[model samples]
Target chain A: MPLEAPVEVMLAASAGNVLVWVVWVVAALALLSSGIAVVLFTNPFYSALSLIGNLASLAVLYLLLSGEFVAGAQVIVYAGAIVIMFVFVLAYLGGRADAPWAGGPTLQAAAAVVAAAAIALEVIVVIALAAGDQLSDTAEVTGAFGSPAEIGDLFLSDHLLAFEATSIVLLVAAVGGVILGSAMPQRSKAGAD
Target chain B: MLGPGIAAYLILSVVLFATGAFGVLIRRSPLIILLALELMLNAGNLALIAFSRQLGNGDGQIFALTVMVVAAAEAVLGLGLIVAVSRKRVELDVDKLTTLSG
Candidate 1:
């Protein structure tokens, strides 16, 4: 009775509980389908578009979980910025790029399937075992839970070093990107000389 | 309070991670590989945020933000490398374009 109390109360108290369930179903379905589409589609452009769909669904799920800031970042950074970069490169590469599944599953592909399956099975079993009794009811979240202000405070206080390290990482990545982008042209120039 | 519980989210994360790994392995295009990598990273982010909600705190959210920045940087550098590779090589396949140097 005690175990079921919180869940039952949550269901009864919220009129929009059904809507949340529906939204979760829809977003989860979109996430899975678009994820599959991203992998299955041969055209990189379609794959990029599919990735965008996947990102959008993930953002919606983040909203359901009260991760408003993460939801916003998922939309902006992933769907907005990263997917755009993919499209630009796809445009540059054009349609002539070689497709992957040209003939059939090679030895490598078969091995990949096996490896992925084994890892997934092991992890899932652990989750099912450990998560059975503990996570039946959700945590009692505070008013400030998942708020940007709270998370920002954590960034500047608890995780300050990590935050600064991330900025340095971004700086390095930016420099790497610029140099890498120009690398080929400089090589060709050297060849000409 | 996603209705299906935290376990559902965890299962979903596993599936997404598996799909991404499969894509990364089978796909020949560098761009698709990068896309798959994004999926994998987002899979981790999903789990982190789900736990953040479950714990009633902002720790996981902060971690998720850090992940986003890293993912962005990774995508930028990866795309740049793809562009660099495309210029010299006629075939843009990862398998074919193996060697780093001439």
Candidate 2:
């Protein structure tokens, strides 16, 4: 009873409360704005940059979730490698900015909006229902939840097959990329010369 | 510390996912579409990590890592295909790709 009192008091402290709220608000805004920019920007390059910003903010959010390894991987893999690949393709396919949204099929757009809204409503209801629930004893969080060692143990023990299979898939993708890139007649001609 | 609760994280994930879906629906460029897809994937990752932390489980984080790898490979192949296709034709718009038309 005494330990619970102090724990609750600590969580209620003004400094920690304000700091968490501030970080959460800033990260959330950055995530939302960058996601919008990624979609709305006319230039592909700008969209790629916005996507990078979104990914970086998402990494920060992951850190807030106490997923340290996931945060790092998000920055390194998504922001660094994937964005670079996107930029490379954008640069290679030089062109004018895409045509302004001329309002594609109205039915498709309406369906998309309805589907997205339905999903959002469903999530909100689920969150409301789960708001009062607490983690089970077996799932009680420790400081090591996202530590590298914990992740490694999980990967090696439970996810070993998946981990190995991902390697194979990546290898195939790499070879496929090479074939697809070289298969272009223009690329082949340039290579021959 | 009074950290943001699971509901906050879930709300953010929902918004992000919705934005990505809207982007995919509204945008015409293939590159932009791909970027939107990435946004959706990241949103899913966020939800997974949030639940993982709530449950004190490492499995979700590992799964997110696997998702990232798969996403990377998908981006590589997708961009490669885009490059090859663009070389043959000038338009990179997705609507014009009616190759499957009967």
Candidate 3:
């Protein structure tokens, strides 16, 4: 009996791979719980830490989705640089963890919740409809899917304008930050003098 | 053979977005609001990458990268503004920022 590749092996290899499932579950849980911690933690400092956790978990999720470059950017830009900025602001603000927060107006909170629920339900329904007859297995990931080279090519070729625009935006943001930071001290000094 | 599908990823994105929305509404601190906004942006990136994977296209990932750059810039400028506001000893609560509330 000529044995072709066994069904079990094929099933174990692709989307049904147990490792993928485990990683997905872990990453999703981390993404969610850390997000909750960000919102619930009273201390803004703690919230920043939680946001870092959330960002890191999101990086992991990006990796699981086979987006290596995105995952790296998530770690570098978000978990590293952005979170550090948040911490600096927290520290600059005296790291006051005990700020009194009499949670915002109740009506606004209820409105937000309702809006969020409605949006969530709409998204779930759309996803369900979209995926109803189209639950395909994970695509065969080629070597070039999320590689830096592929992304760079895309940036240089198709997304050149947008890429250049982003650079300009970053430069502007930097200058604005400097201006905002410097102008304040002088004004405050003037007020004092 | 039930591996996570596009729907699963989409559901996660939706949940994350909703959490961000809830945070934006419930939290008064400008910093927390910025963090929540980051969460929402990340959610958008996640969805983009997921679709990129599903469609076997690189465009989504590229867009996600662009979004990350924008997010970083936004974070920097936002933190700067927050610092400027705090320097004046103005209350950080959003509700109390009624200087322009006509």
Candidate 4:
């Protein structure tokens, strides 16, 4: 009975499971396509728009990963707040589209693609050969797993130090951003001209 | 346990990260670079959450949370610099911003 338990978990099927599977596949596809759109789009504004879609799909994927609280945070923080900042900055900067790899070292672009593909291939091969079957089992979680209350408990207990550190990091980043924004010398009539 | 396993999620992560890296390497604009950087970070987040699910723990989720904060900070600073560069009426290309004494 114990020996067959793992196989049962592996092959488990149900209506809810089927729904989750469908959502996972849809989100995964959206994740990949939007990611490509972010990279391949020459228009930075459109890329920013795709970034929103990309992050939104990632949030959905997070939900499938059992990251309930983090999934919400992903939507609110990354998808909402960060992307809005990107859009605002793009607008303020009036970023006209620029061609990527425009007049650059032709070989460098090729090398970049090759190198990235090599890295992905390397990791996938390692996963497939070494730990593919063994790592397929998802850990059984408690009912309260990934809930905000549970995460907050963690923040106030086990992860208190790191939690506090993140606040400090955000504070420092805010101050640094302000300083950096004004650090440049203005040509008296810079934007006006 | 439904259909795809952790491997599927991880492979997706790898592809996302590689696409981001390729963009970063080839893109000239800082804005595009930052967007690519987000792609890379999300790839990392997806992997973290996948592992968290596989391991059935909140630790990876917390780590992912921290990563999100760091990412927000990075975006703020990067955009601030971009704004500063533009206010100076300087061309906004990372490759061209080689001089410090400008």
TM-score of chain B of each: 0.93, 0.95, 0.95, 0.95
Candidate 1, which segments miss by more than 4 Å at Cα? A1-14, A95-100, A183-193, B100-102
Top candidate when judged by DockQ against the true structure: 4
Per residue, candidate 4 scores C-alpha lDDT tens digits across B6-59 of 888999999999999989988889999999999999999998888888888888
DockQ-wise, the better of 1 and 4 is 4
For model 1, residues A1-193, the per-residue Cα lDDT tens digits are 6899998887775747777888889999999899988987878888999999999999998988899888997898888888998888888778454466777878988888898788789888887787767767778876677777877888889999999999999999999999988755556678867
Runs with alpha carbons beyond 4 Å of true place in candidate 3 = A1-8, A11-16, A98-105, A129-132, A135-139, A185-193
Task: List each candidate's DockQ score.
Answer: 0.76, 0.67, 0.68, 0.80
Question: On residues B1-102, what C-alpha lDDT tens digit does candidate 1 reach at each position?
Answer: 635677778788888988899889988888889999999999999999888888777888898999999999999999998887777665777778857656
Candidate 4's docking class is medium
| Tens digits of lDDT, candidate 3, A85-138 | 899888878765533235544677678889988888888888778775664665
Residue-wise lDDT of candidate 3 within B1-102, one digit each (tens)? 234877688789999998888888788888988998998998899889888888788999999999999998898899888888887789888889889888
lDDT of each: 0.85, 0.84, 0.84, 0.88
Least well predicted 10-residue stretch by lDDT in candidate 3 chain A: A96-105
Q: Compare the candidates by lDDT and give the number of the best one.
A: 4
- DockQ class, candidate 1: medium
Off by over 4 Å in 4: A1-13, A101-105, A128-130, A183-193, B100-102
Give per-residue CA lDDT, model 2, range B1-102, as digits (tens).
Answer: 256777678789989998898888877788889999999999899988987887777888998999899999999999988888887665787888878687
Q: With candidate 4 superimposed using the best TM-score fit, by how many Å does residue A187's alpha carbon deviate from the native? A: 12
Model 2: per-residue Cα lDDT over A1-193, one tens digit each: 6779987877669777798789889999999999989988888899999998899888888887788888888898988899988888887787349743566557777777788788778877876687536522224577787978888888899999998998999999999999888855667668857
Residues A133-169 of candidate 4 have per-residue lDDT tens digits of 8786788887688999988988889999999999999
